[model samples]
Structures are given as C-alpha cells and as structure tokens.
Target: MPRNYASLADQSVFPSISDLPGDYTCPETGGGVFGCLLVEIVSIERITRLVLRTFDRADSPVTVAFYTGDRGRSIENDPKLKPGNTMAILFPRRHLFLDGTVGVRQEHYGYFKV
Candidate 1:
C-alpha cells in the first residue's frame, strides 16, 4: 500500500537505534519508546524474515521477523525489501528477543514503510 507521508510528519519524538535499551520488556508502551527506525537492508531470508543493520553499528545486525499473523504479509510481498534497500520500520513493542535479535511484529501498516 502507498502512504501519504505528509500525514506521517508529526514531530513525535523518535529514538535512534543506539538509544533502544534491552534491559526491559515492552508492556503496552502507552506513550513511551515508540516510533520506527530508518535502517538499511543487510539481507533477506525466506521472503519473510530479514537481517537488518542500523547505521550506528556495522558489527551488529538485527533479525526481523515479519510474521505478525498476515499483518506483515505486505512486507513479504514488497519487492523493494531487498539487500541495500532502506526502509522505515516500527517493531512490535517487544522489540528485543531472547536470542538478542531485534525485530518487528508490526500490526499497523502505517508504521512500516518499504
């Protein structure tokens, strides 16, 4: 789906990739620690998962799982989601995982841009 970026231009405070803390789990963020990150696509896997890299750290790559119960199927179908493409993503509130990979379970299409 196409997006009207004008509507998305609110000055809502967004955290940088380096600012994402892993100490706690996201519990219905209410109004905290929200917003998407601008990241580069490092690699794609199985057409549904992705390995992404933040500009802040080349050594650290985050694995993104896009299986939010068909909520993310559009992401899997997007041709632009390939290596070297840049995209904006709002990960699920629980951005951190047990394996140390950070990713998305985004249920809203508005929060993701391909």
Candidate 2:
C-alpha cells in the first residue's frame, strides 16, 4: 500500500479528448447509444499509465480501472496503462492543450527547487 505520486503534485489530475463526450449512455441498452471513445494516459515515475478504447458500432472492448488517491485502489489491482487523449512531456513545466488535441502524458524526473 505505497502509492504516492508526490501527493498528486498540486493536483490537476489529468484526462482529455475533450473528456470524450459523444452521447455516452447505454449500460447495456438500459438507455442505449454508446460509440466512439478512446482513452490514453501515461504518467511516469509516480506511475499513472492507462489506455482504454470503448466503442459500440460492433467493436466491443471495454474494461477500465484506475485510481491514485482518495482511497485509491482497485484499478483492477493496480492496472498499468491505457486511457488516452494523448500528450506527453512533464519536465520543467510547460504544458498547453487548450481544448482538442487531447492532453496528459507526463514524464518528469527529479531535481526541483524553485
């Protein structure tokens, strides 16, 4: 039980692809209509890696589990990678993805005192 992404580092806990909104609802036709969903997440060192693709135009595959804080555990037993909106570079702080081109795929390693 040791997961500390430096306590989420000021917490802007990432996810993108415009949050992938395409009339998403169909817990198996309880309401029906679900299509076009792709996820990608890649965080290094403190480890937040995920990749998920959810589609329903006869392309079936959806199994997701991810968590890092707030009693975070049971992302399918620490699931590692797949959930993408796509963007990577977490070094010396310079990130900008102001809606649509997706974001969040960070990688930074050590030494910061400012």
Candidate 3:
C-alpha cells in the first residue's frame, strides 16, 4: 500500500506524542532528581525532518534530530506532533541501528522519549 503523508500546514492532523509509549524520564544526576526535561518541537518538515530542543538545562541541553523518513509513521499518522508543543523525553543511554547507522533508536517515532 502507498503511504499517506500529512500536510504540515494542517495542525489538526498532526500526531500526538502523549500516549506513544516510551520512557521519557530524565536520568538522575547528583542525587537531585533532575526529572524529565520539557522539550519543544522546534521544527518539522513533513515526515522528512524533525528537530527538538530543551531550554532549561543548558549545561547538558537536549537537541535531537529525526531525519530522512526515519520517523516510523507517515506525517498524517504521526502522534500529535506540532511545532511548539512542550514534551518530556527520555534517553535510553544506548544506541541502535534501524537503518544501518549508529544512531539513538526511538522505539517509536524514531526514538522520541516523550
């Protein structure tokens, strides 16, 4: 079957990350319970490109990328992903190759921690 891509201009059809299961809790640092950092989807180009950013913890800020059709679902079926949506993501502190590259693997949606 042919894949159906969603239009980025339409915000209603965007995917929601809230229920797309995966651990998003930030790892503990210095016994202070850093918790998960809230990140926002800064950019998205349909299903081809995705960029996320965390602003508070600038010391070890989080800036991740999802590229080149790596996102498991087409844009239409993708979770409620939209620019400016604040999210919490967790890093597995590991790496895997879904497409033969040494990259952090998202169990779902290219490894989005949220």
Candidate 4:
C-alpha cells in the first residue's frame, strides 16, 4: 500500500553541493562521481508518482522522485525518512562534456540506519 504523503512535514535546509569532491570524474562510456551529504526530508507528495524533497542545514533543497514498484516501496520505507532527522544521500555529480552538453548520471543512494 502507498504511504500517505500527508504524513511528511515541511522543513527545509541547504545542501552543500560545493563540499563535494571536485577531483571526482565521470567515465566516457558514462558514469559520474558520487557526492554524499547529510540532509533532512522536507516535503513529500504523491501525484501519480512519489516525490521527496530533502534539505541541508542551510535550507537548500534536493528533490527526487520514485515511480511505482520495489523502488517506490523502498523510498516510502526508508529508515532515514523522518521529517527532522538527518540522512546521508549519495548522488552523482553533474557532468559537463567538452561538446558543451550537460548531463546528470542516474543513481540511487541507500540510507544507513543510525
């Protein structure tokens, strides 16, 4: 069963993307470096899909979505999902190609229960 989106709270924070390693590189065939940070789940919504927005201490937001399936259940049941608790997220760094095209690598970071 789908969890109620109303159960989520609205608290925001700023994620420090700049703190991520700059030396991290992506592969030519396509895979990007991983960037990790501590964030709080601010808001959640279910509109045909599940959406979660996390924030850093500074109130910066990073939003992600999960479609129906095992992945969706995982997102809903994530242990770090409390409204105020801090959870670490690992995401891929944005890649800028020499050809002047920008891309983001798709990857999902799991949470460790604290």
Q: What is the C-alpha RMSD of each candidate to the true structure, in Å?
A: 6.3, 16.7, 13.6, 12.0
TM-score, prediction 4: 0.47
Predicted candidate 3 versus true structure: per-residue lDDT over 14-102, tens digit per residue: 22222122333334632223223345555443435454433322223334445435554454345667666655444332223354322
The CA-based lDDT of model 3 is what? 0.40
- Residues 1-114 of candidate 1: C-alpha lDDT, one tens digit per residue: 987563333424334455553335544664356666556677666544433443423334555555455635546657787778767766424366556766544455667676
Task: Give stretches of model 4 more than 4 Å off.
Answer: 1-15, 18-33, 67-71, 78-80, 94-114
| Candidate ordering by TM-score (highest first) | 1, 4, 3, 2
Q: Which has the greatest TM-score?
A: 1
Clashes of each: 0, 14, 9, 7
Error of 1 at 82 (Å): 1.1
Q: In model 3, which runs have C-alpha deviations exceeding 4 angstroms? A: 1-35, 47-56, 59-62, 66-70, 74-79, 92-105, 109-114
In angstroms, the error of model 2 at 69 is: 12
* Native RMSD of candidate 3 (Å): 13.6
lDDT of 1 at 70: 64
Candidate 2: tens digits of C-alpha lDDT, residues 1-114: 978663322223322233322223334754332222233333322234332233211232222222233222233244343333322222212122333322322232121110
Off by over 4 Å in 1: 1-14, 21-31, 47-59, 90-94
